[model samples]
Target: MMYHHLSDAMLDDYLRDVPVPVGLVARLKQTAVPNDAELDELLRSPPMPDGLVDRLQAAIQDEILDESLRQTKVPEKLLVRLRTIPRARRRSAWRRFAVAASLLVVLFSAYCGSLSALLAAMRPKQNRDTTLTIIELYVDPTHSSLLTMSEADPTTIRFAPPTSAEMAELPIELARLDLTPALGPAGHLLQEVRRGAPLTEDVFLMRRNTLGSPQTNDQALPELSHVRRRQIAGVDLPLAPGYDRAFFLKSGIHPPVFPAAGQPTEAIQVPLVTRTDSVDLTRRLLLEGRTPSPSDIRVEDYIAAVRYGLQASNDQSLVLYATAGPSIFGRQPHHMLHLGVKAPRVQTATSTHMSIVVDVSASMRGDDRIGAVHRAFEIVLRHLGPNDSLSFVAVNHEIVRQVDFLPASGAAQLASMIRDLDPSGGDNLAKGFQAAMSLAFEAEVAAGSARHVVLITDGQAAIGDRDAARMRDLVATGETFSIRSTFLQLDRLISAETVPSSTGLEHASAVSPRQLPWRLVTLATGQSPVVARQARLQVAFNPQAVLAYRLFGRGPTAVTGLADVGVETDLHSGEEASALFELWLRPNGTEDVGWAEVHWTDPATGSPLTTERMSIGRSDIAVSDDETLWPLRAVAIVSEVGQRLSGIGDFELLNGRRFSQRKKPAGWKDVLEQAVGVHPSAGEQSDFQQMVDLIRQLEELALRGPK
Candidate 1:
């Protein structure tokens, strides 16, 4: 078929009432007929039309259908009616051209609505001066607190310290600190405060008594019911000798709602390790024919539970890849942004000295918790190479026994000793931790080895420390010596929160018999070699290009009474982290949508930090069939499952409007098709499908249940 350039006469005929040949519409749809450069240049000009290709395609299809019907024989009445219709006369070329130009203006104006929206969205607004909103993750090593602050808001939100009763709810370490002097009579420490520069939502407060000797201040501080607000320049206090303080305001991980035009930037701190206890619990509940509580489902854990097979950076720099696509869970105009980050891979030169604390308390006997520990140890033994050393400490209401560090050659003896362990009596966890720390401290100093203390328990008893201060001192002493610790809960029979959070532990996990091996392996690999410490990923969306955005999973919500947030999340060698965001792009916006950056302290240097960044633009958008998008597809599927199970209804952005609604059956079908058919089953895709199926069954049962 021959195709020609769209001439002025052709455009005039199409714009006018004059009937044009059916072939003209088809020719316009041809790629060779219209010069893309010419069309794009025209679109770039003022009053240029958008969606020209779509309009042409639609017009061509309609004309083809009309011509096919015209080929068929018509009834006598229809033929007579057609003949009776008025025959329009063709106008002169100049007159026709004049009319076509007017019509073209109207069409261009219609398309420019989207263009105007794009420009308006990008235009700077009054009072919102910053082009970037960076939420940096700050970890105070001295106070052991993880602080995430948004550098967008100037207003400082202040809340009074926890009262006497509220203080009891604080972690053991923080609860023991005497703050009466600092808080004063009405907790009015920072009076006559003033607002300074813009600050992010500061979400944590941590304090420590740095004095060599304890100070006796018997002043009483009254309890207040409500939180007092003050626009303070910063967290400042006239401190007594040897007392240090830090404070920040708090907010949920994702705000209840957001407007694209109002808050175009969305960010979250990427988790270094995968957490699966919540995912495991939800699956267990479904298997037992019971619905899991919404609170029990952590979206971050679910998504993290599925390994995306992302590789680590080969060099010292962090690796970051970002891409966006049409959202599957959300309606039209909503897009999903996927970010995959990897820390640099580091090689370990020294061996690790591990102090394994076992809780042989009778409570562990109920679920064969001891057996789970044995299985976990078996996996640990496999990962322990010739350079590694291990020790065992038993605790039952008190310290039962302690075994000094043994080389990897003693694995057989260690396994034998572990198998011989028996559950009895209760547990004094504080004492157990002390003994394990002592062993680790000794080993670290003697051999200059990596010191790690692993505590395995059923989390059924409290440390027999009435003062609380003593236990805090003990844990702080271990931290002072740079002893790393991890808590492994043998069972979740009790609330997982009961496990001590103030013990300076890197991570706490509940292990089932089936998950014991995998969890241990994950832990082992995660502890392989330290690559980056205090690592954080920050993404800033271009307000002009991106209208609004929201993130999936609880990225960084504040937990009251907790000093640190994700303090234990250090990037291990070859570990990958992922995040998903729902984005609404401005129509006809610039290709420069946003950018991502990662900052972390290099473990080797430990002084000056390192940073790497990548630009996200229109070209970064990927189609469903793109093989490189599997990780993102996997993240999306896992995140959707989490949102559905958690009862946080799916977020939808239609046109420019945003809302939340329960996902429909069709939505699930689309997710399942992508998960099973399109996305590769490289990681936990199969298990994810099972989770999807289970959620469907539960939904079906829910609809059949009482309202």
Candidate 2:
């Protein structure tokens, strides 16, 4: 075992009372001061380095000399005696002093070792890195409504602004936010304070920008919990509580209302915020009496068109809803009609015979018109059961039989022939119907089966008996042969005048029930009265500001106009038909809107059924207060607005004026704002919001003027 030796300078430092290095002091403190046995063993083990003893002696001497020089109180007698001593005697005294200093230094070194032990025993120990950080969030609902503060982590805090969508679902009127454990040198939470208010466009933008900021820590965001209702400032408020350090609070605000002088005063009830759906939004907007865009208008039209049809029952009778109101411009009255026709039940037969006539004309080449015919054939083929016989005829300038009557087994062959056929030449709708009718008649006589003829055309008759009456007569002739006929128009040109006559054959030409095949008789007898001729609806308006109107929800069916005020459509059993009319009203006029009438022939009695005259007076105009009429009104306004926005110039007087107008109508924004106030269902709220957003965008675009 070897003992470590201390440096001479360190020994001098100990004797002079200079601060010892911490490392040496710790080592000395770790072991007791060297024992005498250890010291003697160390001295005997090795000789000290040359001049080491002298160096130690010199250091001690310097320290002693410095201490003596600082003594100001030297006795005068002792100073005189020291000066009288010889120089040689003084030298000897110095040598003796150096030796004494060396001895004292060695003794002080041992005392230093002992002092280090004492110092270590007195020192306290502690962990320097262990620290606790406290994070807190404080909220006061009474002051801050709709404000939320969250402590995401020890170093991050986030402030969330109230969202419109959220407000729409809350009953609060005001909200404020307050954060506690205020930010300090550690970090900050919110850069700015936000107050609660209606989520306006500007507020929406600010909230969006804030949420997108880089400092926002989405993952650490506190989950907000629903809070119990509380009363603040004498008002009830909704508060949503969140994570340990997050809070959301809101209060309600009631609108002021003034009643007429004669009316009794009543407490006002604020409407609770609720979710909204698409239908609800449209309905609310319309009830508020706002001018709707063309798209909005179309939505109502579509709804009306489909809604009535859904109400149809097995009874073949038609259902109708018609109303009128004051136009936005206040001049002419707006007229509307909702019509539904019940469809005929499907007929089944043991054996079937059919004729499909397709027009392969030049115009049919476009819009995949001919392709539509092919698709129809494919559908027909799939429905045909075993023993069903079918024939295909392609007609343009002339009629050509592509496939003669063949059983369902030949369906693949018929389909092939249809696909191979090409379009050319002028349209001859009359000839096509004639050829199809002739084939259907032959099939009826040969098979004594259920015979039907389906004539597909663009309704552009260019040659060969183009007269509408002649075509109707040909269809009647097929009916006499016990063949039912259906005309499918591929283009918009086909009108009620051109569609085949729906009127059944005269009693004189009718085969007696006794002579008719049992199956045919069974379908016609004891069933709901069949629609003989297609039903016709006549619509007229007052003040004559009507420019044009478009119908929606016909669903692959066609409507032929009898005149501006009337139109005709076919109705089949078990099928629902609906029509939505989009009306263009004239500006700056006033009068009672006109009436509507529906005409149809009862196939069972061969008698006509006409609807009672339904009329609308100026007083009948819809107002926002009527909840029942809101949906209707909304649809109508949306339809009109949509048409206008589309730049449709069909309106006679306003066509040119619309494009050249320098200023938008007054109260436009107010109208939209009022519409926004109406509450809707949740499902439709998003759609309604989108419409509102669109309106705002359009307004902005208009402000920028034409590109």
Off by over 4 Å in 1: 1-274, 344-530, 555-569, 625-628, 654-674, 681-707
State the lDDT of candidate 1 residue by residue for 1-707, as single tens digits: 23257788877776797778989878877846658888888778867379988999999999999999987655556889878968888869999899999999999998999899999999976544222222335833343322222234433222223222221112212134665556562234234123442212222211222222112222112211222221111111122221111211222234222323333223334444444555655644554456566645667766666656656556666677776777655555467888876665444356677787888876665544675676467546656656777888988877877788787688667776776877677667777877887787778334555677777776565544452455566566767776766777755343233344433343666654545554544444444455677776777777667766666664323232223344235665445666777776777888887778777777777764645567899677764445346666677777877776666665554332333344444234555556665444553433455556655765655656522
RMSD to native, candidate 1 = 31.0
TM-score of each prediction: 0.42, 0.25
How well is each residue in 1-707 modelled by candidate 2, as lDDT tens digits? 22237678876766799666869977877587787889999899997789999999999999999999986455556899988967563457888999999999999999999999999999985423222233334744333334332232223223223223342222233346676776662233233223443333455545655443322222122212222221111111112111011110110111111111222211111111011122323333332333334322223232322222134435556555544433342233344544333444533445777776777866565544554455345435644556667777888777755567777687667877776776766566667767777777666333456777765655554444335567668777777877777655553222223333222212112221111122122332223323435566554545343333334322111122111222344443433433444354445445544566567777668688876766744455443334324344444434433434422222222322121112224324643554465445311433344455545654554565434
Range of the 10 consecutive residues with the lowest summed lDDT in candidate 1: 228-237
- Measured with C-alpha atoms, the lDDT of residue 313 in candidate 1 is 54
Q: Report lDDT (CA) for all predictions.
A: 0.59, 0.45
